[model samples]
Target: MSRQASRRARSIALFLVVTMVASCGTLPRSGPNKREIFAGSVLQEGDAFVVSVNPRVTAATAVVPALGFSSVFRDAGELGADTIRPGDTLGLIIYENVEDGLLTSTGASASLIDEVQVDSSGFIFIPYAGRLRAADSTPEQLRRLITRRLDEQTPDPQVVVRRLAGDGATVSIVGGAGAQGVYPIERPTRTLSAMIAAAGGFSIAPEIALVTVTRGNRSETAYLSDLYKNPHMDIALRNGDRIFIEEDTRAFTVLGATGTQNRLEFETETLSAIEALAQVGGLNANVANPTGVFVFRNEPEEIARAVMGRDDLIGTQRLVYVLDLTRPNGMFDARDFVIRDGDTVYVTEAPIVGWNRSVAAIFGSLGQVTAAGSAVGIN
Candidate 1:
């Protein structure tokens, strides 16, 4: 062969070798070990009992009697307006006409005293009336007490008692909400949304927002999202009730060549596989083998038997779902695949691509060495 032709052939061979190496390097090895991946699998799909976004409360369903300043005084059967409870601060106003002689000057003299905090004993101290029973007594009732006391000394004494501070009949919100604090219910009626707002709203994602409400000794779980979607489920809050926001216990894991490899937490009630993938920044476009995405979940065998027998699963049952992303129709099926808490999604790399990349690197190094030798020879 001619010298120039021989050199050309050698260059072509080198190029082919480099190309093959690069292609080989790009391909992944044996995909991820199926057993290992399955062992670490944390993905599953099932109906999870979660708190309803708009939880329905049997107590809140019925119309709550209006309890206000005047309502307490009215003889109507409306729960006679809620009275001042323990840990309440109240204010009082006393108005005396100048002709009453109780005041040195005339002209409807009035005295205002604030911060009359109710003690644990349910009593508040009045300027001249001494300690009066306030806990469980309506503002009107308290006003009557003050008026009766002053009536003995003066003709027609008018008194007013109002709650100035201390959650003016509030519901305490605890647990997973944005702010865990007491929410005040000013009117006789307040809804779940109002209570949530008073507690600074929910901090966790709505998909996983679980809330529990405890009234008296009874506790019930509710989903805030569902409640929001269906207004009919929205329940009113009552006095002496405590609300708790709980952390989402359900979660799924995304592994392999995805953009982010971590356990993605979600509410078992609403997350689908497609949605979960989007949440984790989607699969790694360059490395993900569109045809080899798989999801492994623990499928409880004899679930019916277990339910009938009340048997607890000790990890005896499981299932694996392999999905192909390359097929156009597969996307639709994938979209409907719901993700359960503890489900594991694995995205494998295309084998040929890894092999190609490795081969490319080897040939690239050889080219560099060859070029260096040529430079040295020329010098």
Candidate 2:
């Protein structure tokens, strides 16, 4: 090889040797090893199940359940509009045979009633029917009451009642909508999704939304996207129901040698390890140790016990989950791993990289020495 090419070959050889030596550096001192948390094969069937944050760990197969808030929707059912109340407007039409009625002066033999607001006493005054009770009465029931009373004075009476300018039930919506206000609940079974759509939908994708529903003294919350995935979560809306859509405020912290180290919000409630990494701009390829991608969480005692193979474990233990992207199966594990709120994703720096830098520094020193020798030899 030429002189310059020969020096380049030697530098390459030194870099490789230093990298190998650094790879075998001493292990960090720590407490006794817990159960072999280092996993390789897929968790088989009948293995001790240790999972949380959307839970998919299983021995044979991973089965994840829908959000717990789905049950709140189930219990809500539908709101009814069968009963009338005060502040309701009613339209009435009365027709009577003037020839048979002494009270009629043959005016028009018909009466056109504009609109009558129901009084707080649950009564509306009709010309011939006198004061009729309309509150808490369905349209059919009120029509019959007017017909029965009119018949007593006139030979033949016809009466019609129509609801004018009032709604039976309504719900209130607030936050991130084109129009945030109270909206009518017209359908017998108005779902949470329907209400949101009617109110002009959300500014962002529903999957990235956190929705809260308040009814009476109880308030429940769920991800807007989860409601779409599991239909059961699209709960029935009731009268006086208040719904609010919050931003995708859930975030996790990223540390160590990732591309970007900071707290990042989730685009959606459900995320895998790979997605979390992508959120933080993935690992720092040049500096990160792919084998040391760890997701740290303070697991509930039950889950820690199961995964740690310790029945005696309490619910407050912290856990470190390792994912080696350097291995073929590492990506698969990452894909299946779920990330929860407040988790910390850390990527370690590759040790071999440090040693490689040292090799470069040594070569740099040699070049300076050789350049000085060349000047002296020339003199």
Candidate 3:
């Protein structure tokens, strides 16, 4: 080939290289590469805080959403099985020494009063005892009070008070439990865990089962497994308390150059960053940049302040944490780092990938150029 023609071909190749290099951003990619991400660092105009993963950062951001009962749940005392309350039914059997006593039938020394309902005011009345406070008193205590009131009208009165199944003290179990129903707060089921067991336990796996106890205006939640590990979570249940058991809905999104991009639910009570990667089959080995794994999250003000070592940031701050698995302690840092809900895990492509594609494109274009030059007999 002549020198001028060779120079023309060389210039074409150089132009192709420059064009390819300049258009790297237009290349098909899952997300931004490491350099592009670093370009948006906190020092830049973007408000997002970009931080490198390390032991200190991992420790500061290793928090999992707290799942357990609060002080209001733990401090409340348990209700007694026999404590009388409104809406409860009392079964009273009165015995008199003389036949045909005040409350007895003709020629009978005993009388049975079944289904004696306590009024909303917590008072119950007998033919001779009149109105007596029945709520807040145990069966034996109510029996004594009834006898004291009846003794003035009958001689040697004997009384027995039996608390029957009623709606006075009960809890409602709903959602992912083996059986969903309203259960009474009886002797065997006075606490939260016991009531759950009485409802045939949770339907989901214990590791992912979340139990929420709602009493009045407040509610608290804890993992079913946590209830077994921490006794304090097995709080005493109150009447009208509602218990809901459900699978953990926490999940993080995996995107970018990972093996697969999908939203994955938490597999355990606490999921680590490494574990979350493993769930999606780890990073794509071919194009993934081992030093460019990042977790994007909107951290609360308190955690954001602690992570960036700044006090001025407010509200939920966007944070992007970079992880370099090529470093000595990178694997450990990932293991210690916690993956929270609604987080996005991204793995950037290697820098060489873009260069490889550009080179391939240039060679293909060069073949086309040579074919046209030979057709015109330039060589």
Q: Best lDDT goes to which candidate?
A: 3
lDDT (Cα, 0-100) at 14 in candidate 1: 72
Could you give candidate 1's per-residue lDDT for residues 1-379 as a string of tens digits?
Answer: 4667657755765777667665764334535643334444333233321111111211111221121212211222322344587777888778775454563255547877778888877887876667889887888888999888878877777888888764646788887777887766655336776678766778887766777767677666666675677664456666677888776677788987778888877745667567777888888877777766777655554432232233554544554565666676567656666666677887777766666767666777667756764665521
Instruction: Please give the distance, in angstroms, between residue 77's alpha carbon in candidate 2 and its true position after superposition.
Output: 5.4
TM-score of each: 0.51, 0.69, 0.91
Tens-digit per-residue lDDT, 1-379, candidate 2: 3677656755665565556546866333221121233332125332233232222342212222233464655777565464555667788777777654533446566676867988877789987678988987887899888888888888778777887754545788898775799987765338888888888888877667778898888887877886778788888887678998878776788887777778888776677889989887888778787877777677677666666666886557666677777676778778778777888887776767655656665566556555654565521
Predicted model with the maximum TM-score: 3
For model 1, the stretches where C-alpha displacement exceeds 4 angstroms are: 1-169, 175-179, 202-207, 216-218, 246-249, 267-269, 302-316, 354-379
Q: Which stretches of candidate 3 lie over 4 Å from their true place?
A: 1-25, 371-379
Instruction: List runs of model 2 lying over 4 Å from the truth.
Output: 1-72, 75-86, 97-106, 119-137, 149-156, 187-189, 226-232, 356-379
User: What's the lDDT for residue 69 in model 3?
Assistant: 87
lDDT: which is higher, 2 or 3? 3
Please report, as a residue range, the 10-residue window in candidate 3 with the lowest summed lDDT: 20-29
Q: Give a tens-digit lDDT track for model 3, residues 111-171.
A: 9999999888899988889999999999999999999999999898999999886578889
